[model samples]
Target chain A: MPAYVVGHKIPDSDSICSAIALSYLKNAIGEECVPARLGELSPETLFILDKFGFEQPELKLSYAGESLYIVDHSDRVQGPDDIDDATILGIIDHHKLGDITTSTPLECWIRPVGCTNTIIKMMYDFHGVEIPANIAGAMMCAILSDTVIFKSPTCTTADIKCVEALAEIAGIEDPQALGMEMFKVKSAVEGTPIRDLVLRDFKDFDMSGNKVGIGQLEVIDLAIFDEMKDDLHADLAALKEEGGRHSVMLLLTDIMKEGSEILVVSDDDDLTAKAYGKATTEGRVWIDGIMSRKKQVVPPLQDSFAG
Target chain B: MPAYVVGHKIPDSDSICSAIALSYLKNAIGEECVPARLGELSPETLFILDKFGFEQPELKLSYAGESLYIVDHSDRVQGPDDIDDATILGIIDHHKLGDITTSTPLECWIRPVGCTNTIIKMMYDFHGVEIPANIAGAMMCAILSDTVIFKSPTCTTADIKCVEALAEIAGIEDPQALGMEMFKVKSAVEGTPIRDLVLRDFKDFDMSGNKVGIGQLEVIDLAIFDEMKDDLHADLAALKEEGGRHSVMLLLTDIMKEGSEILVVSDDDDLTAKAYGKATTEGRVWIDGIMSRKKQVVPPLQDSFAG
Candidate 1:
């Protein structure tokens, strides 16, 4: 079977770009691999795809009977719908896993690094393939997006070093200027509907049996969310019911302020208070010095679901 | 968590010695790991351990909180009972896998090589650790056991080269004579009970969840099984009931003849006939030139179950 290199649901910049970069690396090593995505691309992901002159990967919902090389994430809930039926040829990820069992043995490299592309960079070196300039651009843009220009708590020294080397290969002398251009597209929200904005970077989680949804939007300012707070909360409520979610959370992050204004819609308010440990004034609270949803946000939500 | 390196149930010489060799290599590389077994040792395995002057690894049924580095097998039915609870740090196997899901990313290297010890040797060279004489002897013995001294169908060119290199390191002038000496203990069964002989190298298979048991005995002659056929059949019935097995097959292999006289105790007789495509007389059939049960026997049984 031909290998489909794919990322998890909610196609963030890192997931989409890393899938492309890894698929390129594997193809260079004589593997028949197709890069694919799991969900619709966010604006930041689209910006990277456009800059790298690549089309968005085909959105695949199920991959039964296919040979899969999963990247970016290995969580079962975020995998293709018929994941168990697929033959997992390999897995390369940097996240806490969900229970994904394969019928046969395969290659798996799960590390504690920041971005999946960092692992891909190491593979390119190992295989002695020089990263093409466009693929290097994709990797560099992904590291910047997932680590929030090294501001997110998940960023590691490996990420910092790899991004610099990739920048040199891609002929980008000023990575910070390119990052600002990418974030400018990320912060724009004039013509986009509020519901579309809320769903742009949405991710779902399964804690025990309870289904939870977390949506985050990074902007230079929080007043965009403040103006549409009521509409976004209403949309989140509808999304929770429509998606059969037990709770819904929105992390409106201000990159310049380096903080988040988290909005919650949970059946238990006390559980939310216990999770975040701050007063719920109008169902929102400020979290200082927090940017990583993977590190800071998901753990508390998982604990609250357990409680 | 400290790593617990384990082999499959029914600890054959290859499984036991490979686990010990892998644990040694990991310890040499600064990993805190303990070698473990899943069941009682076969006489052949005991012979190898005593020859190597090594104690038996701890028999472990379950390892809940420890990190696991599974070797020799990846079948969950043959792994620790609480396999899902343990953190899977790595996997090194040379078999078709069972459904084992880990909660985190890990290092997995599964190949179609002849033995797990072959893979361990590759890892030793990759890590620049020189295999000592005794340790190389253990790996050489395991390769001999698994490949049936290069006569089994599963034996590859890699296994032949690896065994020769290991023999040089192990200071064995004539490895063939050493293997014959080892086979002496394997064929000796004057005082061994009928049940103990049957259980000596028995292994179970899970074919789409149906439990199938295959027992093998390699003797210099088959006159022993011919005299004890009725008692062996009765004991197999008891073992099938006790183990909740769907079928039980005993392959009375003769080393001199290089073939097996198979005894069948299946719910479907036609399936067995179709699986082997051989005529049977009173539940016994002589198949010529069959040595490797994994390569030549189990595939047809799995297909019969599929039908």
Candidate 2:
């Protein structure tokens, strides 16, 4: 069987685009790989795929007995349920090293970059493989999405340079304008179900055996979520109880304003206060300059949970 | 202080040379780094360093409050005692992914190659840094030592290509002859202390919280250790007791014979049978084509322990 190139659960643009682009590169280098996703794509991801003239990857939930090349994640919590039973052929990620152990040796290309696609682009260059224009477009948009259009603190020079190169290959003249267009699609919250909004960019973490779920919604303005905080909090509470999670958080991130309004629902009342040193008022708190969840939020929460 | 690049305890040629060569590459890229050894180097490593006109790295036991770039290892058990207190700047390894998690994003270049020096060589090329002849010579010797002169099962095409490139840089006409010369030095077992032999390439593993120590001696012949097996077993027993380890194993690997005679001194009597599916006589068992402790021995033992 051909190896499956898969991404994390609750697939983001970087996760989806990385799987596709990396699978293309691997096939170009004579490796039989099929792109797969663990969950449904969000509006932003859908927009990027449609704009790039690409089809959504096949959905594959369980990975038992399959050869997998995981993309965009290294954490077990973010992987398929039976990942332990699967043979992980390789891992391409851009996050902190997570608790995943393989019995045999495997290929790994993990870096402290802004996006996995940036590392994928470097791999393409290393192998001297030319990326297709549509795939390059998808990869460029993935970088823009992950780095918050170069406004996020996690954005590095490598990410910017990759986006520039990918944009040239993709024939995109105004990448920033395209980024705004993608975020505009992501900002469409009206008439959307509360669960859909919360689950759009959700991820569950296993912090010291305490399951914590976090979701983010990036938009040009925070006022779109101002009137919906109560419903979002109710939905988060239901999600926390349904998943038996210790806490469920939703970050209403205003990309232009460069901050986030966090709505937290937890079994413990002081969860936010302990993790961020900022007390929550009715399970809500506003933090300045908090943009990246993988960088800014998850680390502190993981440390707090460990302590 | 510059970031210290160190390898696993009981340093071998690959461990020592990878640290030195990677530190040199980092320095060429304007990153200040110092090569360090976690423990005493083996005779093989010492020979390679001396032949390449390089000094031995400084020994450092504790890593508390220091910035570290780990080479050839990712497991916490094989790292410094206070590694949890230190900041791990990056990891460059060729082993299975061990249980090590970082809170922040870090650079990682792990591959299923035969040697860490091969991966470091790729890093040098990736950074467009020219490796010095001395470092190239040391790296080539390290690869030869780890891959058993291209006879190991862990050896890959990448490793062979890297050796060819490094041999050109280091002016090595016959790489296999140099490999044989290094093995002759490694095969010198006469007049060596029992403790020094056992501790030469030893490594401690935390298997389900049960500390298991394993060591390997790769030589051109196994007959050299026939008369010394009893003393080695006694020393392993004492070492196990002193360190409170559940087991201590030594692989007398015959590189030329392409096999190993395993001397296991474990708390349990059936460890060899359970781990390798082979019956042992007086804590000794022979297995054909078992030259790599990391590949052939450790994985099965780890799985058996986990079970």
Candidate of highest DockQ: 2
Residue A256, candidate 2: Cα error in Å is 0.7
TM-scores of the first chain across all predictions? 0.96, 0.98
Listed per prediction, chain B TM-scores read: 0.96, 0.98
Complex DockQ per candidate: 0.31, 0.82
- Candidate 1, residues B256-292, lDDT tens digits: the string is 7889988887777664678889956877889998887
| Candidate 1 lDDT | 0.81
Candidate 1's residue-wise lDDT over A168-215, tens digit each?
A: 999999997898889889999877898888888877788768888888
Model 2 residue runs over 4 Å out of place are: none
Give residue A178's lDDT in candidate 1 (0 to 100): 92
Those runs of model 1 whose alpha carbons end farther than 4 Å from true positions after fitting are A58-65, A83-86, A122-130, A143-190, A194-224, A247-307, B13-18, B25-29, B47-53, B125-130, B147-190, B194-224, B249-307
**Residue-wise lDDT of candidate 2 within A167-203, one digit each (tens)?**
9999999999999999999999999999999999999
Which pairs of residues collide in model 2?
A: none
